[model samples]
Target: MFWFLLIGLVSGWLAGMISRGGGFGLWGDLATGVVGSFIGAYVFNLIGLSAYGTIGSIISSTVGALILLWVIRMFNVAPAAAKKK
Candidate 1:
């Protein structure tokens, strides 16, 4: 559990930095990272990939976090665009 939390925080911070040049604050990053880890595992499993240990977890979480952020951005854009129409 400790390692999981640590990996989530690190991965989330890294993902936020990579995706948007900064983090989504501490709690937000933690939540994003933890959820991203689950998302990463699910997606990777679907694609026949597996992540192991700390490094693997970080990589998977980062990829998942990126996807999550992309989806969030896409939805954010849609609502605004719909409102304009």
Candidate 2:
């Protein structure tokens, strides 16, 4: 449990840095990372790939977090696009 949270925090912060945005702050990022870890695991499994060890886990979660953030941004943009039309 503790390791999961720590990994999530690290992955979230790393993803935020890589994605180039203000980020969701601490708690938000933690939530994002926790969810993203699941997402990453699922996606990797779907692709018939697996990551080994802690660093691998972080990379996987970071990718998932970026995807999660992108989806969120896309939804936010969709409404504004509708409004513009």
Candidate 3:
């Protein structure tokens, strides 16, 4: 549980960092990032890629987190002209 939380924080921070540097604040980024970690882990496992418990695992998780965040951002970004129309 504790390890998961730490992983969440790290993954989140990394995700936020990779997401174009500074749109969301720390807590918001962290929250998005934490959730992203779970999504990332799930996707990774589904793809038959295994992340061992090592520095490499952390790196891969971070990459996965960034990917998740990117996808989420795309979904959340409403088309401005569409909104007006």
Best by lDDT: 1
Candidate 2 stretches greater than 4 Å from native: 78-85
Model 1, global lDDT: 0.90
Where model 1 places Cα greater than 4 Å from the true spot, the runs are 78-85
Please list the residue runs of candidate 3 whose C-alpha ends up more than 4 Å from where it truly belongs after superposition.
Answer: 22-26, 54-57, 78-85
CA shift of 58, model 1, Å: 0.5
Across residues 1-85, which tens digit of lDDT does each residue of candidate 2 receive? 9889988998898888878656668997798888889989999999988989999899889888888988887777466568667
**Alpha-carbon error at 40 in model 2, in Å?**
0.5
Over 2-74, each residue of candidate 1 has an lDDT whose tens digit, in order, gives 9999888998999999998999999989988999998999999999999987899999998898888888887
Residue 67 lDDT in model 3?
81
The top-ranked prediction according to TM-score is 1
Say what the RMSD of model 2 is. 3.6
**Model 3, residue pairs in steric clash:** none
